[model samples]
Target: MSLGEDGPGTRTRMPEQHAGGTGRRTQPQPRRALVTVVGVVVLLIAALAFANRGGKSDGSAAADGTSGTKAGGAKGSSAASATAPTGQRPVTSKTAGIPAGFAHSVQGAQSAAANYAVALGGVDMFNAGRRHEIVATVYAPSVSAALQSTLDRAYSADAEKALGLTSDGTAPAGLTFVSRTVPVGAKVTASAPDAVSVDVWCTALSGLAGQGSTKPVSSSWFTVSEKLVWTAGDWKIQSSTQKQGPAPVNGDDQAATADEISGAVQQYGGFTYAR
Candidate 1:
């Protein structure tokens, strides 16, 4: 007896031996038949084991939800979609024109950090009165006064002139000043019952836009980490710092004209970011 060319559990018959004179034939050897059967069973068992191993590996990959093979077996990262929605309703109220009344959870802290980053990096930061309002609204009382004092000097008249803005932080005649921060994503680094630390990745547009403008609008990427505390039933920044990003490769799209850029900025309104 021998195995056939087909994969597993394929049986082949052995020729019978002929008797010398009585024209009688004997059955194939029982031991040989037994050996053939055992070989076939072992092959079947191995095939099943290999199939199971592959199934388990695929299941593990699905559970991770971070990566997978694409068409033609090329691997691709799924990290961008790893953030799952929490299904909680976003804050519907504003305190001093900033989103407030966050839920007392990690997601709430992340949302607050992202919105605060936006408020801090806005064009209003160049205006003394508006900057003071923003600082007071987003920051804890313990730090707002000092922060406002520091910012007042930082955005003084000399700084405005250096940036081609007037003493009032307004753009020159026939020009539009652009300073906006858009939060890309947020992550909670640490969490507690009444406090949390979150890092918000952001991209900003700044400078002046108009014909023959020396300070053309430009884009930048950065990350802001904020330590927040739950004060008066809302999240407020206790302290914060910013660092250069996590930026992507610059795209090769053609640059828009100054008027087009200025128009787009004016037409589009900002959003209240949530995790």
Candidate 2:
């Protein structure tokens, strides 16, 4: 979300000058303080720019409305249906990444929310570093510190041990720690120029699901409600909560092969939700 100005142009070294009649050597002056200040300022600007970026949103949904309410497509905008999304950016973040709002209108908040859902709910989230990255890139700055701290406590050493992983979330040899989210759909529950709320339905995979694994990966359907704010030039999370169900019953059909499941995870990529 944050963007920065490129570094200062190359410095030209000055020739040594005689300080006195004798070859009083002129020592090279280090621009350490200047460079440090420039670096800090650049980082600060980028952080502020990204933190305060504006996002588009519709005013249909209100604060007093019921939770889990869905907003219709026609009522929002025709921006998403105008063209197909290219690459991995999602049908949403068409011109920007990290939940950058749609460029055309104040309605792209739905898209930004959906794309962020994918980023937050991905399998990589289980990792401590990845979790921090998710919060930093997708969450509002005010809450990220607290959220990550809470997550750090909850995702404890014992939790990792139970999942057959080390304290840092690394899987044991010959095994993989899998926690992936596959998005099903997205909808705007509420929207505004500076804020938006979206719900995403998804299926998540956890555990190895292989032989000799007690925590065999199983599938569960869940919904995530994300409240976003326009900050630093992108939509950032204000808060989020999850719920179970709205999922369909499983058929009696036999489970797919392990290789089949793994292959599907690799071959079938995720989507950037919209509308």
Candidate 3:
């Protein structure tokens, strides 16, 4: 991000008059070039300050109470645990096999947002059939129908190519399509009896993980803010947006080989995140 500064202030000075019948004007020369140079210098300094503002990985997630990995929570902070348990069993019900019927509280809304983030960012989103089911399951009924067509266009053929999937969203033979988001924690930014906003910080791993793969699985950090509405007995997704990270510093761990990444993804099972 860059910062802009206002141009330097300028003042007009009155010319001097000599005490002679023949009137003459005398004035100090305006250092217009110096003023211009000074203004430019100030702007450059401001821009640099703004750019360097977010350069450090200060062990925090996004600004304003966003959940981030490691640095995001206090030491031993169950910060990930929003108001937990709602005295109800998790996954009380499922819509199209996606979790639904969350408790109508801040905790419940946070839980719903976290789980929906996983479903929305999953590899299933790449496949048309599965994507439709997932969207219908998670999105509000009022918007789901219209959103389907809009989403189909957004995730076009070119998008699939970029992800190493076929135009139809299938991975090539002998390859595994990987897309998973693990939520670090959830924060409720706003709430009401019928509407709520929750921010979920997550680490996502995406790309094809297989031998001879050109796009290998890699991780990215991001924050997703979701507006949810309570309707027809459950919380439904209204809208969401994602932004890049307050990512943590990389450790000195050795990088895994492509085969290793593929094997791990295949063998590991994902969890249903909740508050």
Candidate 4:
């Protein structure tokens, strides 16, 4: 008979004793075998049911109304929203030719970091006058003077000459120098009412772009971290540092000619970054 054909408590027939043999009846071997098989089947079904219930419970909890509130909680939500753009309008003012008047919020901190990074990484920083203006305008009042002094030393005449520029930070004749930072994204690492820290990921083009130039324009990726404080009704850099990127592999596109690159740089304008 097939397994499970009879109920658990069903009785099975026993073989009749031989006429001349002792009359005590014995339990049937087949009945005992059937019972053992049924028990094993029942136990396997119960185990499978338990495993499925555990899996579904976890899934249901994640699918509860809120978005991205999975097993990792706030961390998961932050990761989901980090690069997602909000439709809020960007700041509409400038100070010292740099974007200013950011909102006093986490998004504002990120926006400030990105815009400050662009200003700091521009070719203007190579020029003493422009560099001093940028540092004064972007950095906190308490730190601006010291920061300016340090930068002056770092971008000295020797440094300009090494980069194929004149002592005044002018490009050599017949070449256009390119130093531009394009922010890929920004995120706030820490934030409070009065201060915040943000990281801005950027790709930059730097070097001389023209025929006969030894330093052809090249691209690089880096991340800049800035600590900003709310001072004088604006977000200003208190400190800053940079590190080499989470760079992607270089693509196979052919390099543009010097004239083309220089023209493109001149025609395209930089942006006012926002979160």
Q: Root-mean-square deviation of each candidate, in angstroms?
A: 31.6, 19.8, 23.5, 32.6
Candidate number with greatest TM-score? 4
User: Which is superior by lDDT, 2 or 4?
Assistant: 4
Which digits, one per residue and each the tens of the lDDT, describe model 3 over residues 1-275? 11111111111112121000000001110000100121111000010011211111122222222232222224332243333233434655667666678776555677788878777766666667977998888877777777666556656777566656778876788887766667776766655567766777677676667888886666767666677888887888776654457588978988788778777777766665556
lDDT against the true structure, per candidate, is 0.57, 0.46, 0.55, 0.57
Cα-based TM-score, every candidate = 0.70, 0.62, 0.68, 0.71
lDDT of 4: 0.57
lDDT of 4 by residue, 53-160 (tens): 110001111111113221222532344142433654568777878878977766666677777877776777767787788788888887777655556655667756
Worst ten-residue run, lDDT, model 3?
Answer: 18-27
lDDT by residue (tens digit), candidate 2, 1-275: 21121111111112122010000001110000111121111111010011222222333443211122233323433221222332222233332233455432223455555566556545455567766776677767776766666555545667556546666656666554455555555555665556666665566665553456655556666566667777776667676655454678787978876656555555554554443
Please count the clashing residue pairs in each candidate, in the order shown: 0, 14, 1, 0
Cα misplacement distance, residue 10 of candidate 1 (Å): 56
Q: Write down the lDDT that model 1 would get.
A: 0.57
Could you give me the TM-score of model 1 versus the true structure?
0.70
Runs in model 3 deviating more than 4 A are 1-88
